[model samples]
Target: MSTQQSNRVTAVYRTTTLLAYQGNPLIEALPPLNSFIEDLSALRGSLKCTPEEIHLNGVERAHSICRVIDDFFQPLSQHIQLHERISLMIRGGYVGRNPDTGDWARHIQNGYERVLSGDLKAIKFTEVNSTAQSMTLIGCSGNGKTTAMKQLLSLYPQVIYHPNMNLEQVVYLKIDCSHDGSLKEICQNFFRAMDRALETSNYEKQYSMRKRLSIETLLAAMAQVANAHALGVLIIDEIQHLSRSRSGGSEKMLNFFVTLVNTIGLPVILVGTPRARKIFEADMRSARRGSGLGALFWDPMDEGREWKALTDKLWSLQWLQKRDEVLSGEIRALWYDLSQGVLDIVVKLFVLCQLRAIATKVERITPKLMKQVYEDELRPVHPMLAALRSDDPEEIIKFSDLKLSDTDKRLLELQQRVALSTQQTPEEFAYQQLRTDEERRVYMALKDDFNSKLLAPIIRQIFDQNPSLTWIRLLPLVHEYLNNPELSKPKDNPKKPKSTGRKASVKQTEWHTLDSDDLRFIYSQTDSNSEIYPAISKSGLVLNIQSLLEEAS
Candidate 1:
């Protein structure tokens, strides 16, 4: 049958069928677990900063350290499992028979119709059936579940286009559950996310704006859109918002999730705090249907190997004047006690302590200093940290409800000031003075070779001697001075080359392997140095060739 005719038949069958169509098994599309683990293990992110980059003064160092939080992600075992589960869900959800080469739609329609007619006994054994998989991520506040999910999802493209199949596949869509927990609002969020992903406002414009639309109609429309776009996975963040009292009660919301999985064949991942446990417990069958890949409960890092590893890695990123090479027993114990092994609290505590250390000019981190900072700078989170230390679940939840607005605001202000300060040119700073563009350029070129303090005086001396020299003419002179400081001063007896034998014979074999400095010396003897040096340097053959020649020789 033609593609157009097949789609029409399938649509008609879908309307009459009671049972949803399950696509072909997705096992073939999924990589082996080992391969998946390897791919996930290879994922890493860190702020790119060298020692030179971190050589900022006190205030600059504090701000730079704060900025590291933006990219700091330490992978753990939960991260590996999260990657594997999500990868499977995405691969499985996208696995339908090839639209270009197979009559898969016909098979789906037949199976769906037969199952709907209550004639499962009559259905053939040859039919393929598969459903979407799901996983739940439950964690306490600031346990890094949300951050981990985002990092892993970032590895896949948001949209994939298959030209042969004429399909635009959405790899993943993350929607924040509405604070009110209404299914209608969740549907609208889905439409908005779709519009954002596809860069088309059609869905939101058409369906989301229709206030009269019922939850069932909205869900049906969402499923249709999901299938049409071949959505791989749907992530609902802040799922704890779907409380029974807030989101039309638990039963309705639970059924909605079931429908999403069974009807649309779209994998759904629910990420929320411990409060979400009540929702799952309210409906065990619905929870089972939603979580095919099992749930990951992320708690605070224990004071074990993982905690030590994380703290040790983060400890190395300190920008203090006095490097804490060895994490002292007192400091380590105090750190775990103060932060309670919570990743977010641990990092913030570290940052705040660094700032305090700098402001006080103590120039080093210590147990006593950390305690003082905790009491002074981290007052907002003290209760939560205390509750965690107490090991009281109810008290912990209650205290954790507090947000670090004051601390975060201070950090942001510091970051902004640092950003503005760093934006100024080296000449703008009070400590360094460059009187002219020529001086600045020459200093910059040789800054890597010599200390800025040492190089500045030399640059000033060269410019003072030749006030009329252009930058281009001054560059060669600067290079000469760098090669020999005595060349900058007056040379009474400049050595001239002695013609050993009228001239040395040029050998083709030796010429090819000669260093640029040697080549320049030979070219100058032959009166071609000026012509050759610029071309050789511009072509990048002169800069790094000396090491190779030295090694070969």
Candidate 2:
């Protein structure tokens, strides 16, 4: 019973701590912060259990409350950081687990948003409808900003969302702002997003709207459709793209965004990285007057007393789930030593350690397992971690300025190398077996050292054979002959290995389609909308009769 009570007091400490660090900076492991956590662990370690002593207050209860007073209240009495810690935690103190839903972390963030709404329904009391509203979801990289917004979008779409009551005339659209700089490109992507939404909405009554719509007709049609269906929310994601500017282009895009809210009266929700706060502040200068777009401060966990608070919250969260889960004060001390209580590091360490424990069939999370996960899973993050570890103001800005999201950017070039390595030739396997990523990098560099004698014969042979056709196809034929064919046996022109295996006879039809400059999209290089149109639209009775009259003429 004494042991259980000790655990409860420890639980309270963590619950209190994590609540403090939620939207704060990544805390450090220096003096007071580390000492505070250590002192609490020491207090728990020193607690003595007694079955006797006719005292009114339980011994365990006294120890628990004293630990809080000594480790928290007393130490915090002289520090301003501690005061800030208490304030933020108190702000979110009411956001407990929902009785029915029981989702804790998400519910609290939801509660934070609800505070603005001034109602239990979690809709802002202000003009949630009939007004231009935007939210700056501010966070640096690895803070789960994008993932949180995606989750919010998913959750909000499923809920009973509205301004006052009218739900019939509502439409919702979500678009990533990185689509392009031009207003036309942004509008074009808007239509594309709307087109997908219409396909998903799948309302049969809107069939005519869908049928009459081409991609180009999407924006004007959506504005009309919103009036008809009542478009309520428009979510513009990745507003940091405005920082990714081209002269006055971002201003133009911002103007179009303003036009959507001001002219169309559609409620806009802008989600962006920390840099987007600059764009919003800039916009509030001239044209964007009276815009009620508030910023949601999603700061990362800060250091000092806040770190201990964050660690405690994260620990208690687990304790609530499994009282018998082996992590005591000893484990929490070890965890804070390695991870610094940055939520990403803390969360990822858990995931990796869970996998590690399960792989080794261990019953509990181990400090050794934590070390291994840190080396393997968390070491790659050391560069960014080192940057965060610095105290320079410039370093802070550099860390905050996520030029491209390191987490979201595709490692496709590496993947393509792996894919190519999977399909290696016998010559490649014999000569080159790249054992590491760096080894492979070196191998690619030395590839240009090849003699022309290796290639000259191949080119000579290709030109010797299919003079009428392109060398692109002929080179592959030559490669096939050399790799898999028999030169001595006249093996049915084994140069054409695919043809040698099987032959099919079929008539070929010449294909022709006229294309304008706008009909192309080369991904990274091109921005113009596709100008191509198919010949299958309704001229109805008028277009047919006009065609007939033209024929009569």
By lDDT, who's the top model here?
Answer: 1
lDDT of 1 by residue, 251-360 (tens): 87877786666544568998987778788888777777666788898878888888888878778877865556778666888998888877777888888777765554
Alpha carbon lDDT at 44, candidate 2: 34
Q: How high is each candidate's TM-score?
A: 0.65, 0.41
Native-vs-model 2 lDDT? Answer: 0.39
Please write out the lDDT profile of model 2 over residues 419-510, one tens digit for every residue: 44434553364233222233233334333544323433344444434444343445445455455545522123445424232221111210
Cα-based lDDT at residue 132, candidate 1: 76
Task: Give the Å shift of residue 550 in candidate 2.
Answer: 99
Residue 324 in candidate 2, Cα distance off native in Å: 7.2
Screening candidate 1 with a backbone cut-off below 3 angstroms (N, C-alpha, C), the clashing residue pairs are none
lDDT at 82, model 2: 26
- Scored against the true structure, residue 526 in model 1 reaches a CA lDDT of 32
Off by over 4 Å in 2: 1-130, 150-172, 179-185, 200-228, 242-248, 281-284, 287-291, 302-326, 330-342, 360-363, 391-393, 401-553
Off-target runs (Cα >4 Å) in candidate 1 are 1-37, 57-63, 96-130, 399-402, 416-553
